[model samples]
Target chain A: MHPAPSVIFFSVLSGAGFGLLTLLGFGARATSQGWPAFVFFAVGFVLAVGGLLSATLHLANPKNAIYSFSQWRTSWLSREGISAVAALSLMGLYAALIIFFDIRVAPLGYVAGALCLFTVFTTAMIYTQIKAVPRWHQPLATPALFLSYALTGGALLAGAVAHAGFLFLLTALIQLWHWNGGDKAFRNAGTNMNTATGLKGAVRQFESPHTGDNYLLKEMVYVVGRKHAFKLRIIALLFAALIPSFMMLGEVKHLGALIAVALYFTGTFASRWLFFAEAEHVVGLYYGKR
Target chain B: MTALPETTQTKLGLVIDLDTCVGCHACVVSCKGWNTENYGAPLSDMDPYGQAEGTFLNRVHSYEVVPDLGTAQTVHFPKSCLHCEDAPCVTVCPTGASYKRTEDGIVLVNEDACMGCGLCAWACPYGARELDQAAGVMKKCTLCVDRIYNENLPEEDREPACVRTCPAGARHFGDLGDPDSDVSQLVAERGGIDLMPEQGTKPTNKYLPPRPKDTLDTDIDVLGPLLAPVAEQPKGFLGWLDRALEKL
Candidate 1:
């Protein structure tokens, strides 16, 4: 529930990067070989790889991160790491063939595109699988929203403004739905102080275990003021959805795409912050914080 | 390796009594003291003299419970890892660092493999795991794995430090898997309950609920007859003094 900056950035930037890679692998022509093609692919690689690297920043022990891919059979985070690496590697090879030798292996491109989307799904599952946070446990809440954002942002960067406009509007609706349902998720989770302590009565926390802050409080008991969150929601809708949707749909060509991309990133960043901040972890019930 | 074993050979856990825990937090201190020196890494304090933030495997919380038929009562709840049969913390570990031992059903974090991503802590509903800020690894109640199996220590000292240090004898350590075990029998007799059973983790540890209190009637004065006067008027010398005062 802590709106950690590194994780927020990682989610937003990597989602966008994978989205861009998906479009490039599927839509780009075999003859497309030059600085423009290189530049586009370069942007995708930087965003994806840079975002992945930023995730390591939050790790208290980064030295052991190499072993993270070992548990893919059961761990969503492990699957995510493996999926991202595989997607990136395959996409890298696909890009190299076209960029250097002008060879388009159509099948390779298709497979890479599918892998790109799968990587995003794995990333989304990392949050969705956590039943401790009821808001994120919903399939429509995290997985749908993440995929929608990635596609919309990807379309915009790929210069498919018309497609991007429609996707942006769809993503906005999903974001609204997520917020509407997430507000009641914790209360409806059937977890309270009574259930937490297994006491058959109206139980109230008389005293916490410690006098000062602990890791659980800092990590899982974030409180965002309702008024500030409301204001931020409006800002996110206007920039991430409304503004971009209007510009892209109207077919404004004079630097419109560039401006829309920038605004969309800012908007998604704000929403991503709320994603972590608004979530209520079940552990909060034990502390009488939920 | 993150996958849980089908069944553990033994379920070694604790049985805590809510009625007996006095909120003294001796168990918390004893656990911290023993774990810091013996475990994978020392439980470090960020600001010992100031804010005093530190890692602790076990903690005691006090709760005020107001029953429908009785007066409010204070209950001291000492919490640590329940070492659930289906431990989510183990499955959520990206590395094979977190595991539930099939031998004794103890959940442990391998400090050497832990990246300290804090995902295991997030997955735990009970807030059992804490990321040690100094060691940069996840830490939790190992159920004193080192002490329990060590042949060097005295036989009586084989239990967990918290169970050994509990002043009120509120804590009990034994195999909860066997139906005939002392802890299992205690659970059967006292109706020991699991914390958040709806979560369906099937926790190994059990908690005995506090007994009902304030059953006596407040309106009835049981001591009134004993304090009542022996005579309606003053006796002997006091009676003469009263008559003289009346004449005046």
Candidate 2:
């Protein structure tokens, strides 16, 4: 569960991008807070597309990624792809309409908004559906991620600041609750040495399967300290939710708004890092790394 | 194609016996040697000599099992892909690259279509799948699909490399789907159990547990306390030893 920097970047950047796009979809566009409609839309698009492109950074065959769009029927990953493409296209059309002809279609905005929400939902499901990583597989994961995206995106967008802030606080509390639950999830996941090997009686790893580092150890066995995680969680709560909530109460129409968004990004990045680092894969039991 | 068959025509898998495996790693090496050359792409290795860490489809792990009241035994456990009836690896593949064969039920990765997202490796509970860092693709035991189905090879050698090279005769290859098959019968007689049955993967592979030991059943003569040595004990060698000891 090593959090590849590229994936971490993709999740945080694309989340903010999609969040901004979701806000743009309501036809309540804003040119205030040093974010022009065109620039805003462009930045959001770039972040989403950039995040998508970044995900391919780890791919062995990036060329074959196009074929990935084919399995939308079964895979959550494919569903995410299709949703992202469709959402991006709808947002493109909406932006084009607003930019080119000085027109605004509320229905198109709503359509893009709905699709945007679906895209993020699919993204969250991609991790939640993985039963091996019990930490992410929970009933609370999807809503927590969805609310996080909306709150962050809403801050970058305009109107409903109070509503989004309140939701952000709720989700932030849930994130902390979910974070605590993840530790218990690994403990209560009920996977141990005996279960892994299907053997009876007391079993301990006398020797590792390999003498040196291998693919499984390199990829799955990530060890982050609990103390460090707690500190980061508090930092994430402070910037991602608390301070942003306080900022929403103040007049954050210009510089204050940018500062708030910056703080939120920093906070979200910390949480996302924990999301991967804390994930205990079942395979780790064999090596006694869990 | 990511969807598994309603029922596989043949559940082709290996039944590994833990009681006999000596942790020799012959099957591991033979598996690596055969699949690296036979398969679609080479099992890529980074710093294959300096790091000497190469992709291995089969891995032999040795563990010390100490029961509450019995002596400990070292068991060598060989693990690979179980090619489950409901393989999450295939379903999670965003592309139709990962699939289970309808003809033989050997789960395989279509390298041409694989994007190497490494999600399949993560989905697998048993550390069966591996990401080839050199090739930038996910690699795993293919049940030696290339060798198992190769008509060029002799009929006797049409088994997986691991089965053929296992010096201890710990690994067996056959269709586990048929109740009358040798492997199926072996499972019935030996009570071979699946690894992590709770995951509900319904793994085709089975591991035969180590045989129970009888601690109190010994046939050797028990030793008793010796009488004090006589002053004029025994003959030539015994006399010399006694004299030598008296001199000391």
Candidate 3:
């Protein structure tokens, strides 16, 4: 569970982007048309697309990314790619109709909004479906946390400060729950060195296959100290939830909202890093790591 | 195409004998050598002379097992792709690159289609797949698909490199799908077990558990009579010498 920067940025940024797009599709009014609408939609597009582009950085051969859209029937990653593209395309069209033609297609907006949320769900499923990592295998918690982050971030950007504050608190609670449950997920996964090796008694790894690190060790067996994780959790909560929540709830004006957004982004970034770093892959049991 | 086939015509896998592995990594080396040259992508090395990290399709791990009733035993566990019946690695591939052959039941990665997103590696519970840093594609044990089906070499040489190179005869390769197959019978006889059955991947590969140790009776010495004197005094010339020495 390597806390890869590209994936972290991709998930957090795109989650927020889709969240904003979902709001725009469903809540665009007459007064919010033209230049203002264009600006908001533009930001959404940049964040969504740019986040996707960053995700390609995680791929060693991104040139073959086009093929990634072909396996939606089985692969959550494929479903995610298709869903994101569909959501973005539909939202882009919906935005154009409202921003340029000054026409609001209610049905299109509703469909696009639903698709946007579905895209986030698919993105979350990419992690959730992995049985190897018990912490990320939460069918409910993983998606809930992702959606909460999206909605809260989206609400803040849409200037619904009160709504954003409420959502932020909810998200913080979910984050706490996820972290608390994740701490014990691996131990409770029923996988140990004995089960991994199918040995009768207490099994300990006497010798590893390689003297140096391998891809499996590097990618899945990443170890973060508990003390550092605790400190980062505090930082994540303080910036991502408490500070932003209080600021927005207190009806902070223009400058304060922008600062809140920055702080929230920083916090979400830390949270996303922990999402990967703390996850224990079952393969580690074979190595006697977990 | 990432969807698994309902049933494979044949389940070809390995039956590894843990009792006889001897902790020698010859299979690991032979697998690397054969696969690097023959497979879709050469198993690459990052710092061969210095760090010495490289991609290996097969690896041998040694474990110290302390049984409740017996002395601790060292077991050599050689691991590679199990080629599960319901292979998660295949299903998790965003591209149709990872797939199980409906014909032979061998799971393989189409290097041409692989984007190296590494979702497949993440999905595998056994840590079977490895992303080649140099080729930018996922690599795993193909069960020697090329060698097994190829009519190019001698018939006797048509097995996985690891199985062929195992000096201890710990590795057996054949169709496990057929109950009458040699490997299947070996598994049946030896009470071979899957790696992690709880995961429910339904792995095709099986490992023969190490035989129980310290079963011999240590209290009674079988060599006691052989080490004891044949007579109370000494026999023949030794008796005469003992008597003369006693007189002196």
Candidate 4:
């Protein structure tokens, strides 16, 4: 869990886009197929597609990503990739129908919205399903991620001021619950030095595997001081949850909504960074990191 | 291809003897030398002369185990791929790149299909899978697949390089699925235990713990023989004879 920047950005930005789309979809009945609809559609597409493309930055061969879709039968990453494509395509078509045909199909919009949420869920599952990463491998990870999207995207939409405020507060509570619970999560996973080396008695590393670093050490072994993490968590909470909730309550206008969106992005990014940094991969037991 | 079989035909893996391993790193080097040439990708070295970070399929580490005791001994632990029965690296793969062969239960990566996302490396608890940065691919111990099944090699040579090159005979490779196989028998006799059984990967590889050290006898005078002769040195007349005898 190196917490590659590209992945962190992708998750936050794309989740926002999908969240915005979901908001728009639900309001399709009241919202018109007019200029404002076109604008929301454009912004959501840009963020969504751009974020998806950015996710490939960590891939050694971005061109080979197409093959990833073929493994959806078992791989959560594959399911995420394929679902993102389907959600984008359907949502794009729905927007096009509104712009060109002067039509807003309710069923199509709802289907696209559901797919968007599913795509976000799959993205979270990419990490949550990993048994080796105990922090993410809990029932709480998906809820936290999905709720984060609702919090950020609802702020971006700003159409229903009262609803967004309510969602924002709920998301913040869920985020706190997930964070606190996840902190104490992986200790019971049962990975230890004794289990790693298969020795009955207490085992300790007397000598390192090498004098220099290796790929496993570089990629999986990361340490963040608890004090710094606590400070960052407060910042993440303020910006991601509390600040946005206050802004939505104070003013649901365009200016307030935009500011909330910006803060939510930054907040979620910080939280996402902590997500990877805090994750306790079982391999850490080998290096005595956990 | 990434889907694991309900049951593999034969579980081929390794058993390491912690008691006899001297930490000489012979198996590490031998595996590097043999596999660097045969595996789909060369075990490349970045700045071989400068920082000299070379990728090896096998690595050895030393550890100290204490049990409320005064003494300790260094135990050399060598690790490689365990080829787990429920190998998550294969199932979590976005592409069908990483896989375990159902026939012999040897896990491998199809270099052509690997996108090098490094998720497989993350799922492995043993720190076995490593990303080859230059090749843009993940690498692990192939169990010397090239040599093991090579028809051109002699029958006796059809074994993992690490096992064959181990001077202390600490590494053993064979079909672990068969109860009568040499490796299986050795595991049974030595009471071999799987690494990280709690993880439930059902790792095929096993390790034999180091044996206890012999207790020291404090009651018997250990330095008595050497000090006694000097203390009992004959008087001046006979001292010359003792000195002559010592010299002789």
Candidate 5:
């Protein structure tokens, strides 16, 4: 149920990117925020398109991605696909509305934000509905994805507001801590043999059910060493937790904020990859040896 | 000639017994043999000699259960698609490749429509559906639908390949909706149970409860306990510790 990094990045990045673009699309028409509007609009469009292409690459049959939109009534995946496409289309229309009609609709910004947030929810629910992948079923994944969107969006917003003053750094710092805390929750609700095997109070033992490897083991169990995990945990904490704090505090150079963004994206992508690799699907039971 | 009125209801399913099953896996082999030949594509084996890679519709798993300390008994559970009333797999299929008949509860796949997304397999808790790597489509137990409904087949032999070929007579096939059906009556008399009842799948197939070889009614000898010493231990550091623990 753990989507590939390409998928997770596609959701978190595009969601926040679209959300910010929608806000910018509305901002362009408002006489009050004219100069600032172009900045948000440019960045939003770049991130949205970039993230969408990244997501599309993960599909085995990209042409059939269009078919995914047809089953919204029964599938959250279809709902997510439809909403993402709709959100993108609306953003385009909003831009046209501002350019041609010279219309300034504040409610459009709110609607776009709502759509972006719903995309994130649908993305998270896709994993939550899975019965075998219990790690994704924890209460943590939904909130974690939501807060990640907010923090990522907020960081970009703070960078945008730097032209006004240094004041927005405080908000960015607070959001950074919130994002990292959610990441910790995601890591701590670790899936273990006790849950996977359903042994209860008894000790569960296994004799190599298969003589050789199969698909489940190859896909699910990554050969993540303890040393490597510890090392990566440090990296995740440093980027997601510490560097952002330093950047906001002005303890580092102004360019450090950009470094923080790079670090956060790289660290989160690695963590997401590990999340999928580390999770032991119960189907492993058919072939597992313990 | 005028057309006959169509029956409003048809219920298709399987019945499995827990008590009589010997865990031989004959049904598993028969199912694989029948489905591979009849389905969209044969269940291919990638490395037949080097590794096990063929697709299977049914698998017999063995579980050991102990009722008492005397001995443990092996429970053979043959699992496949349960054809549940609330099948999430059918609902989640985007291409309409997966569907459940309203007339009969049988969930089926249209191989031509399946894009090989592998979503239906994830939705199934029983691990019933498997991807046929060669065909690039999902496959599973059809309850021998082709054979069961074939008019050319003998009336006595019309059933799933697995049920018809079972050496132990462990599997039965019938309509549970009718209370008088043999499978239904047997289930009522034996007190069958569903695996993982909390899932709420409402599986049409029922497993007759396995009766343990031993029971809790075994008599305990009284003489061993009566012969044990009640007096204090020999006086030492160990004795003092033992006395202190006993005093509590």
Candidate 6:
């Protein structure tokens, strides 16, 4: 709601990190030999979970963050926290299963991957659950976050996959689709606001309600120049979806994997920034002209 | 076990009618006036001359609802604490300052117990609880607890100030816990809806449905029929001068 870039980056970056780790964990067990896969899994998992935990520490009162787990029955914030912790624990246990029991417990990789998928689902739900934010309200938002995690994780997993090269390419394409959908959601949100505010019709008369700036005006209502926002959206679309997609399918298969991963991650970061910035909170209507 | 008093039940709440509300903000002004003296800390404005800042318990917000019609209608929604049955604010309070009463389901803050931690504010979805800067305590709509129970005040005048001063009769104060109360009956008849009900706050305060102006169902032709026409002739010197100028 604050539209803080730090928070937006924290969620998207950590989400991809979690997605990458969860896939690596699953790949480890799917493989015949477990040592190389375990290395990738451990690195990805730590980067994802550690980043999230560090970001959460910046909260003014981290002690109350514990109570965030209590409202899982209703609140998506609670559900996200719960699933994140659960996914982390499951990944840790999966690692233990590999170390202690050899490759025998490799099937647990599936469990860890499932848990990670669910974790991202809950994370996506955190944004989707908020009705006030029309941009985040789309049905596409959940799946886009879901697929971004998969593509990000799959790209990381592509480095570990011994034979299935197509999986990586497929995942990249899915990520591209997700990015397109997310961009459309932002567009739809803008259009919805224009319609709701009566800015869409032929003759538009706009008059603001507040005589002076208020808290809602300061926090919720953000004014982004149309030309600048359009340019940014194009940049985000190229970085997040198109370039990564092309690289993933390019001639140099081995090199393409690395390029795709880099492009996807960078694009996701930009896209995530756009996600928060482009969103217009309906509460802003109170300040907007009648 | 001590028996609960049948008549002295406490968790007071207000139900507001969006349909009847004229959006005068009398309730907001009255709330500020009453709470300024009674509450532990008064709402303060840091730079009233320069920046215009002050805290208030009640603020009225206006919204536009577009129906299947040619024009969009305005609906005013007044925001305040709903005193939820399952208050996330209470659960998130580490210092035990925010607590819900089992007696009346009203969530309240104990100023003495508060450590100035703002967890409860973030936990609230409705944006009801606000931090009081001067006293370093959280303040909210108390359902006018002091006024409602004051024995010195006459029975007719004992209700919350917002309800008493509402010239539009949009505000209703009563026990929502009782099925037969005036507030409950109003809610039932109007099919009141909660703001963001998906948040699962179970807010006690409900908003009545918006009424349509088309419901008047009157004929414009019938009202205007047979009205005498107004004269359009110039009088005295102006009339004669106009005729002379035309002739010249």
Q: In model 2, which runs have C-alpha deviations exceeding 4 angstroms? A: A30-35, A224-227, B215-248
Question: Best by TM-score, which number?
Answer: 3
Clashes of each: 0, 1, 1, 0, 0, 2
Query: What is the per-residue lDDT of model 3 for residues B1-113, given as tens digits with 9 covering 90 to 100?
Result: 98999998699999999999997899999999999889688999999899889899998998999988868889999999999999989999998999999988999999999
Off by over 4 Å in 6: A28-39, A54-60, A96-104, A139-141, A157-215, A225-229, A250-259, B1-26, B29-55, B62-77, B81-158, B164-170, B175-248
Model 1, A1-290: lDDT tens digits are: 99999999999999999999998889743346866677778888898898899999999999999999999999999998998999999999989877887777888888888888888888888888887898888876789889988988888888877788899899999999998888888777787788899898899889999999999999998875544888889988988988999887686674988899999999999898888988889888778885
Candidate 6 CAPRI grade: incorrect
What tens digits encode model 4's per-residue C-alpha lDDT throughout B48-159? 7777686778999888887667566678999999999998888999889988998999999988889988888888878889888788888899999888998899988899
- Ten residues in sequence with the least summed lDDT for candidate 5 chain B: B1-10
Q: Write the residue-wise lDDT of candidate 5 on A1-290 in tens digits.
A: 33466776775567557656644544522553334545556566677677777876654434455566677777776777788777767766665566556665667765765676566667667666665545555455444544454345544444533321232233334434433553454235443333322222322332333345433344333444423655665565565445565555554455765676676566555455544554444455443331
Report, to 2 decimal places, the DockQ of model 5.
0.12
DockQ (C-alpha based) per candidate is 0.73, 0.60, 0.77, 0.57, 0.12, 0.10
Per-residue alpha-carbon lDDT of model 5 for B82-151, expressed as tens digits? 8777676776666666777666667788776666667677666556787775666678788888888888
What's the DockQ of model 4?
0.57
The lowest-lDDT stretch of 10 consecutive residues in candidate 2 chain A is A27-36
lDDT of 6 by residue, B59-174 (tens): 77666555555677666667788887666666555445566766776667767666554546645655577676566667888878778778988998799889999999999988
In model 5, the clashing pairs are none
Over the stretch A1-290, how does candidate 3's per-residue lDDT look in tens digits?
A: 99898999999999888888888888743368899989988888888888999999999988888999999899889999999999998998999998889988888988998898899898899899998999998888899989988887888787777688898899899999899888888777787787789899889999988899999998999986544888899989999888898887576888998998999899999898999988989998878885
Compose the digit string of candidate 2's lDDT tens values, residues A1-290: 89888888888888778877888886555343223567778877998889888988967778889999998878989999999999999999988877766677879989998898788888888888887888987767545775575546554554457665775677587787787777788667777788788777789888988887898887888875545988888888887878888878766677887787788788888888888888888898888776
lDDT of 6 at A71: 55
- TM-score-superior candidate, 2 or 3: 3
Residue B116 Cα positional deviation in candidate 3, in Å, after optimal superposition? 0.5
CAPRI quality of model 1? medium
Q: TM-score of the candidate numbered 3?
A: 0.95
Off by over 4 Å in 4: A28-30, A224-227, B214-248
Global local distance difference test of model 1: 0.90
lDDT of 4 by residue, A12-74 (tens): 888888887876666533456677678878877888888898899989766567789888888
Give the chain A TM-score for each candidate: 0.96, 0.93, 0.97, 0.94, 0.71, 0.75
Whole-model Cα lDDT of every candidate shown, in order: 0.90, 0.82, 0.90, 0.82, 0.61, 0.62
Ranking by TM-score: 3, 1, 4, 2, 5, 6
